[model samples]
Target: MILDFGDGFFLRQATVADHAALAMICLKTGDAGKDATGREDDPDLLGLVYTIPYQVLEPDLAFIVDGPAGACGYLLGAADTNSFNARLVSQWYPDLEARVADPGPDSSRWRGSDWLRHKIHHPDFAVPQALAAYPSHGHIDLLPQARGKGIGRQAMAFLEQRLAASGSTGLCLEVMPQNVHALNFYRTAGFKVLQDVGLPNRCIYVAKQLGFAPGVAG
Candidate 1:
C-alpha cells in the first residue's frame, strides 16, 4: 500500500496516457463514492459520461493523483458551463452514439447508462441559478484509498487556484445532498452552500466566488 505521506503519491496534469486508469477510477468511484464495478456490465459508461469529456475538450483543467498502485483521484471541469454543454451536444455526443445501448429494465446496467441515453437527446445544462453566479463547474472523485491525508483538498485547491487565475467569476460543483462527507470537504475548501431547491436527482450545487478580496461585498 502506498502511504499518503510524501513520495507515495503525487498530483499531475492528466493526459491521454492516463485514460485507462482514469476510466477505472470513474467506475470504481461511480456508486456515490463506492465501487460501481458490480453495478454496471458496461464498465466504461461512467467514464464515458463523466471522466472522458474534460480529457478530450479541456485537458488543461483536468488533473489526477498518481498513487504507487495507480490513479488514486482526479478533478476535471469546464471553464464555461454553457459553452461546454453546447460543445458536448454539437461535437462530443455524436461520436459516442455508437457506444450507447437502450436503457431498459436492466438492473445490471450502471445508472449512468440511463443518464447517457437521456442526455444524448435531451442535452441538459447546468442550473441557471448556479451559472449566473459561477460559470465554471467541476466534478471530482477520489478512491477510498485516496481519502484523508489532504490529497482531496490539494486537488480542490489546485482547481480553485487555476480558476481564479483564469479570471473566472466563480466556480461550482454538484454534490449529493446525502453525501455529508463530500459536503463537509467542500465546505472546508471555502465553497458556500445554497439551500437545496428541490432539483431532480437530488444534486446540491455549491459554489465560491473567485478572487473575493476579503471583506468586500460579493
Candidate 2:
C-alpha cells in the first residue's frame, strides 16, 4: 500500500505487523533525552500519542511513511469521540491533580489540548461536531532519515483525499508554537491555525478543508 509521492518516498496505511517499525519510529520521535519516569525519554511523547490511536482504532485512521527500509513516519486520527480509549484518560493519568508534580513543568511536559477542545473534540458517548465537518484528525511525524523527502506533504494530501472520499469535510490537528519548523511545514501544506489550545507547550489547532466527498481514489 505504498504511495509513490515521487521524490523517492511514499505514504501508506500502517498494518498490525508494522508495530515494531512504528515502535522504533515512536522512540525516535518521542525521544526527550533520558528520565526516571521512563515517559519523558526519546523519541518523546510520540509513542504515547501513536500507540493510543493504534490500539483504540485501526485501518480507518492510521498512515505511515515507507521508504527503502521500513516505516520512517506515521499519521494518526481518532474520529469517534465516544471511543472507549478516549474515556480512559483518567486511567492513564490517575494523578490528574498532579499537574505540578514535576519540578520542571516548563520542560519535559506534554500538552493536553485545553478542556474546551477536549469537551468539544472528545464528547461523551457521542460523536464530535467537528466530525460532521472534519470527521477525523490527527498528528503527522517523519523520521530524520525521511525528512526533506516530501513524505509529509504527500501524506497530508493523501489523507485529505482519503478522508474526503470517506465523507470527511475537513481534517484538524495541532502543533506547538515553539515548533516553528513544524508550524511552517503545516502552513506550507495549507493548514491554518484555528485557535489556541493553551496547553503547557502552547499548542494551536489547525485544520484544512476538503471541499468534496471522501475516499476519492488518486
Candidate 3:
C-alpha cells in the first residue's frame, strides 16, 4: 500500500507495526492549544499505543506516512460511532481515570477529563449526527516536508472513497479557524463549514460530501 509520491515521499496503509512512528508524528503535531483526550500530551506514548493491539481492535480506518526510519505522519479513523469513537474511549478512559484520580484544581488533566466526560454524556455522544454516514472522519497530519504535495488531499480522498463504499454521505473533521490554509483546503476539496465545534479554542467543524473527486479547484 505504499504510494510513491515521487521526490522520496510515500503514502501507505499503516499496519500494527507502524504504531510507534505514527504516534510520534501525532505527538509532535498535536493541537497543544487543546488536547481533549490528554493523549496527545505525550507523543512517544501515543506512538506506542498506535502500533499495539489497540488497532487490532479496530483496523479498517488507520494509516501512516513513511519517509525514513521515523514516521512523518498518520491518519486514523472510525466508520461508525459505536465502533471507532467507542473503542477510543474504551481504550483511553482507564488511563484518563487514572490521571484524574487526584488531579487538583490546577490540573489540566482534570479539566480535560471533565471535558471528555461531558462530551461522552452529551447528546452527540448518544448519537453523533456526523457519524450518520460521514460519522467517521478525523485528524490527518504530515511532517513539514510533506505539506503542499497533495499527500493530505490524497489521504483524504482515500478516506472519502472508503466512506462512499460504506454509503456515507460525506466526511467531517475540525480545523483551527485561524489556520487559513486548512480552511481553504477543505473548501477547495468541496467541504463546507458545518459549524464551529471548538471548545478551548475556535476550531471549526467542516464536512464534504463523500462522492466528489478531489480534483475540484478551491
By lDDT, the best candidate is 1
Cα lDDT of model 2 by residue, 18-56, tens digit: 766666676665522111124433232344334544643
Worst 10 residues of 1 by lDDT: 1-10
* TM-score of each candidate structure, all chains considered together: 0.85, 0.64, 0.70
lDDT of 3 by residue, 1-218 (tens): 55666666776777767766665565555543233234433345434433332355556667777665546767666566466556656675455445433334343555433433433233133444433445556667777767788888887777777778977656777687766777788888778876423322445777776654454322
Write model 1 residue lDDT over 164-193, tens digit each, in one string: 888887888888777788889888998887
Error of 2 at 28 (Å): 1.5
What is candidate 2's CA lDDT for residue 172?
Answer: 71
Give one clash count per candidate, in the order shown: 0, 19, 4
Error of 3 at 88 (Å): 2.7
Minimum summed lDDT over a 10-residue window in model 3 is located at 116-125
Candidate structures ordered by TM-score, highest first = 1, 3, 2
Between the candidate structures 2 and 3, which one is better when assessed by lDDT? 3
Q: Which one is best on TM-score?
A: 1
Query: Runs in model 1 with CA error above 4 Å?
Result: 1-5, 104-112, 196-201, 212-218
C-alpha RMSD by candidate, in order: 3.9, 7.6, 5.9
List candidate 3 segments past 4 Å from native. Answer: 32-41, 45-56, 68-70, 99-102, 105-133, 196-202, 211-218
